[model samples]
Target: MNAGTTAERVYDSLKRTLANGSFAPGARLEPARLAQELSSSATPIRDALNRLAGERLIEMRPSDGFHIPRLNEIGLRDLYRWNEVLARTALRMSRKSEPTGGHHIAPIDAADLFGFIAASSGSGEIVSQVASANARLAYVRHVESSIIEDTADEIGDIATAFWQRSISTRMLIQQYHKSRLAIVPTIIELIFQDTQTIR
Candidate 1:
């Protein structure tokens, strides 16, 4: 493939790896190791790392180079709250718009559910912001499932409220974030535990 294609390919691959929580939190990302693992040169790996940093999926330090961002309890709570705000903004913006059809029940993937909510706002910018936040929260949500019981039920309720455009939609959203917020400490501990065992 061409140079641009190679870079894009590496970027996509690296983005998924980072989003999936392949590396431990606060772990330094060695370009050479990633280059060997990705079967690409260091240049493309660096490029991809730079892109991921811009998305806040990873951190880049002048002194230490690239590392997975360690999510602290406060930062994690803030992210959850910020996403709730974004989703609520979308819901408010779309209030006058009629809810679309296809309201059948299905397994609610957290990312897709949030993305759908954001898309309802009819604002591309909100959709993009929610998408980014969802990406960052992907692994944390996975950890949450282990810590927080009834996750599927919670997501299902949120999805149902959203599709029906019920008056309770906003309340459900707030509850969802509050549930996660309540367990921020436990969630952070489990995340680090998983990092130690798995990564």
Candidate 2:
């Protein structure tokens, strides 16, 4: 393949890896070494790193290269809060006019559910952004999930309620916040984990 194709391929691969926390929080990513790992040249590695950094999956420092960012709990909470609002708003606005057959039930996982809800906004950009965020938080979510009470069923139930018209949008949003708030301790532990801290 051409250099450009190689770079694009490398970018996709690295985006997945970085999002899945393969590099770990605060890990240093050297372009040359990463290029070697991917069997590509440093140019493509640098290109990929820059792209991931743009999505906030990795941090790029001038002259210091790429590093995995330490999770900012406060920032993350704010992001989650707003993302919920957007997704909830989008869901509320669309459920009335959109086709009901397709959205009969929510996805089993939180990320997919959020993506599905965002898709209701009729914006491909929202779906793509959610997918990227999903990748970055997949590992952390997995860890956090293991220690916390699983509420997948509750989320599904909420979706069902919405689908059946048994609940209002306001109620759905409130339950979403409640389900998330229930896992506070697990998230707190995750944020302070030694591996998650910026070195």
Candidate 3:
């Protein structure tokens, strides 16, 4: 394949690994090792890492190379807060007509549900930001499912409210973030344990 294609492919793979918490927090990402494992040259791996760093998915240091960002308690809370704000903003800006409840009860993935809410705003910028936040929080949400009993129900409620155009949908979105915020420590602990186990 061409150089551009190779770099793009490497970028996608690395983004998934980082997003899913495959690497432990603050783990160094050596492009040479990644290139060997991925069966590509180090150049593309470095290129991909640079792109991910630009998105804030990976941290790049002049002397230290690349690493997965370690989200502290405050950082985690701030990320969640940012996502909550983005979701609420999207909902408020959406001019979509009231839902007819045609597909209100269909099963929905949590990330996709969030995407739907964001896309409703009719703003490409908002959609892009929400997608990035969702990716960054993907593994955190997975940890939530393992620890929180009502995650599915909570997400489902939000989806239902959106489809039904309930006035309380906004409230459900707030509650969702509030509930997650309450368990930030537990989420972090589980994520750390999970990454440690795989090491």
Maximum-TM-score candidate: 1
List, residue by residue over 51-96, the lDDT tens digit for candidate 3. 8889988899789999888777899999999999998998899766
lDDT of 1 at 7: 95
Winner on lDDT between 1 and 2 is 1
For model 1 the TM-score comes to 0.88
> Whole-model lDDT for model 1 versus the true structure?
0.84
Identify the superior model by TM-score, candidate 1 or candidate 2. Answer: 1
Best by lDDT: 1
Residue pairs with colliding backbones in model 2 are none
- The lDDT values for all models are 0.84, 0.69, 0.82
For model 1, what is the error of residue 40's alpha carbon versus the real structure, in angstroms, after optimal superposition?
2.0
In order, what is each prediction's RMSD in angstroms? 2.3, 3.3, 2.6
Residue-by-residue lDDT tens digits, candidate 1, 73-151: 9999999999999999999898455445445545467787788888778999998899788878887888888877888
| Model 1 stretches astray by more than 4 angstroms | 95-107
Best first by TM-score, ranked: 1, 3, 2
